[model samples]
Target: MNVAVIGGGGREHALARKLAQSDRIETVYAIPGNDGMRDVAEVVPEIGETDFEKIAALCTSKQVAWVVVGPEAPLSEGIADYLEGRGIKVFGPRKEEAKIESSKAFTKDIMEKYDIPTARYKAFTDYDAAYSYIESVGAPIVLKKDGLAAGKGVIVATDMDEALAGLDALMADSDAPIVIEEFLEGEEFSLMVLVNGDYTHSFEIIAQDHKRAFDNDEGPNTGGMGAYAPVRHIPESVRQEAVDQIVGPMARAMVSEGLDYFGVLYLGAIVTDKGVKTIEFNARFGDPEAQILLSLMEDDLVDVLEKVDRKEAFTLTFSPRYQVGVMLASAGYPGSYDKGHTIDFEAVREKSFVSGLKQENEGWVTAGGRVLLVTGEGETIESAIDSAYHNVDQVKFNEGEVFIRRDIGRHALK
Candidate 1:
């Protein structure tokens, strides 16, 4: 079977790599794929991910059996619905179901209606009204844009001045409503579940993502700095509680709300002293999180997604070894930075996933904020982390300094 994977990031690259491993799949094509994916999947550099007409034509021409979407933007824009309307098989949620990730206000309303555990939040359209709400709530607040902000739209402020400035910064250039939420203090973890509009569908192994750009969780938030699987910080009891009180309820609630959600549901939650509460929800597998999570999977990824598409019975299995993925970024990332730096892929020792590299006359150059993700697996978390960073240290970006967090998986190791 020939499958076409959408988007051209680390997540999409990881998905393409995993799906290509399936013996059931004969070919895999990546739309606008990066330079590294040429090794495993055929690269189609002409069509854009959001080019619905072009994508449909490609599927028809290639006799593509299944179309797997990797990014959230195309899903929220109703690409799956468009393709399915033309009788094309897609493994993603419809537009209405994608509201769970597209609109923060909509997600908060759903949580409130279903009595799910979450933080106190208020949506505002007027600047004065939003400022008044912030004053009432005091410092250490979270300001989020109502629509998609690429994961950096959220601003965590420490004081009223910073809060107001953050809100102003978000409101300065856009008219979209902003959601002011009370900050939840706890350890954060990522729980990604596969579903076919069924509340009883099982979830994959729990993983944790480090969103902050630098080590010790002290820096601006980027797409993702690093990630690891089988998070030990989240106890078994808390994990079960999250599945019961959070993931299960949300899945059923989507059905009740008349939304057929059929894809990966990512639950970004925090284990507070009081209990487990949701921090945010993503409509698909996370970037660096997908890197380590998919690395540990023992089951064929294409078969799993196909089963979800067919609503057939299939279970997800994982290796017991701990997996760690550390991201290598261009200097001054999560901020303004330079690109087109030459990168040495030959120095890399183990499996490494490329994100922002394109072939140039000289060599592969850094083309995005996050350059690559080097992953390693071992019997112990400490050994995995050690191996991951050791391989990361081998790669070099000649034009500028490459920054990486040395403390990835440290919290779990401790």
Candidate 2:
């Protein structure tokens, strides 16, 4: 069987590698796949991920048995519906369901209606009203763009000036509604659940991503700097509380509303004083988190997806070792950065997943903000973190136009 994965990033790279591990899978095709995926998948650079018509054509031509949507943008645009209309099976949710991630207001309403634990928030389209509300609420408030901003739309303004500036910038960027809410203090973690609108499964392991671009959790938020799985400090009881209160209720509520939901449900939640409350919801897998979590999986990813699609219970397995992954980004990432600096991946090619690369006769060069993710595993999170950084040290970027956060797994520091 052949499978096609949509998206050209480190997350898709991890999905391709795992999908290729399935015995039933004959070939894995990465739609507009990056150069790093060539070893694991047939790169189809002629087509773009969000081009629904061309994606259907490629699926038909390649005889792709199943298509896994790796990113939220294509899913939000109803790639699942388009592909399914042409007799192809998709692993992501439909258009309406994808609104959970595409539009912050959509998910906020559902959370309020379902009595799910989340932050106290209000949505606004008028710029004046949003700014007024921010002033009324005061500082240490959270501001989010109603639509997708590649995970960087949120601003945790600490002062009144910062809040007003963030609101201005957000209002200027898009005409969409702005979400402002009271900041909830707690530790944040990523919980990615697999659901088919009926059955939902929460993994025993949970991963936490460092969103800030620099060490000590300072600097602006990037997509994700790094991540580690099986957050031992979180405790099993807290995870269960999250599933019972947030993940399970939301899935059932969507079903109650007659929305056909499927695929991964990424919960960006915080363990606050009031318990687990959702910060945001993403329709697909998290980037660096997927890189680490997928590595620990002992089961075939295809089988898991099939079971979820069938709405049957699945008992998945995992490696006992803790997994860690750190992203190597082009300098000045999560902002403006230089690219086309030559780099090498041969040393860590097997164990690392490369992204944002432009192949040339000389070698591959940096092509995107996040260049690649280097992962490592160990019996302990500390060792796992060490191993990942050790591999990262060997990689050399021409002109040294690269930046990496050193304290990726600091929370697990003993």
Candidate 3:
């Protein structure tokens, strides 16, 4: 079977690699795939990921059996609806379902409707109203742009001044509405569940992503600095409760609301002292989290995704070893930074997943904030982190324009 994966990032690369592992899959195609995927799939750079018409045409022309939508943008833009309308099987949620991620306010509203456990919040279009509410509530709150802003749209402000500044910045852009909410304190983890509209599904082994840009959870959040699978912080009982109270309810609620959501339902949650409370919902797989999850997966990904499309029942098996993925980002990442720096992936020994790169006569140069994610697997979390960083050290970028967190899986050690 021929498969096409949309999006050009670490998550897409991981998907492409996992698909290639299926003996049933004869060929895999990536639309504008990164350099790391060159060995595993045929990269089609002719059309952008959101170009639904061309993508549909390509699928028909190549007789591609399945198209997996990776990033949130195209999904939010109704790419899945467009492709499915053209009779192409897509492994993603439709635009309406994708609103769970594309619009924070929408998800919060659903949470409120379903009695789902989440932070108290109010969505605001006016800056002054938002500011007044924040002042009334006091600080240590979360300010989120109601719409998607990559992963940089959120500010966990500890004071009024910071809250106002974040509100002002986001409100300046009329397109960006803001959500001010009470901040839930606890250890956060990523729970990616595979669900059909029926609410029947299975959960992937839990993986935790470090969102802060720097070491020790300091600094502003980036897309994700690194991730590790089978997190110890979330005990089995807690995970099960999350599945029953969070994932299951969310899925059933979407169904009740008349949404046909299929594919990955990414739930970002915190293990609070009171219990697990949702942080956010994403329509697709988490980036660095996907890298580690795929590394530990023993099941044929194509089979699982096909089952998701068909809403069939299946179980997932995973390797026992821990998998850690450390992101090597551009120096000023999650902010303005230089691009087009040359890189050499072959020199690195660990498995490298490229998130951003452009091929030139000179070599592959960085094209996005996060350049690459180098992953390592081992019997222990310490060993995995060691392996990941060891390989990360070998890869080089021209002008030393890359910065990596020295303590990716350090929390696991503690």
- Using TM-score as the measure, the top candidate is 2
What is candidate 2's lDDT per residue for 252-370, written digit by digit as tens?
A: 99998889888999999899888889999999999889888888899999999888888887777889898888888998888899888888867877878876787888698889999
Predicted candidate 3 versus true structure: per-residue lDDT over 154-253, tens digit per residue: 9999888988888888888776678888989888888889878965565647888989999988899889999998887568887888898988899889
Cα deviation in Å at residue 372, candidate 1? 0.5
Error of 1 at 224 (Å): 0.3
Candidate 3, residue 351: how far the Cα is off, in Å = 0.4
Model 3 lowest lDDT segment of ten:
196-205
Clashing pairs in 2: none
Estimated TM-score for each candidate: 0.97, 0.98, 0.97
Order of quality (lDDT): 2, 3, 1
Per-structure clash totals for the candidates: 0, 0, 0
The CA lDDT at 183 in model 2 is 92
Model 1 global lDDT (CA atoms, 0 to 1) = 0.86
Q: Tell how far residue 201 is off in model 1, in angstroms.
A: 3.1
Off-target runs (Cα >4 Å) in candidate 2 are 398-400
Q: Which regions of candidate 3 fall more than 4 Å away from where they truly are?
A: 398-400
If both were scored by TM-score, which would come out higher, candidate 2 or candidate 3? 2
RMSD of each: 1.5, 1.1, 1.4
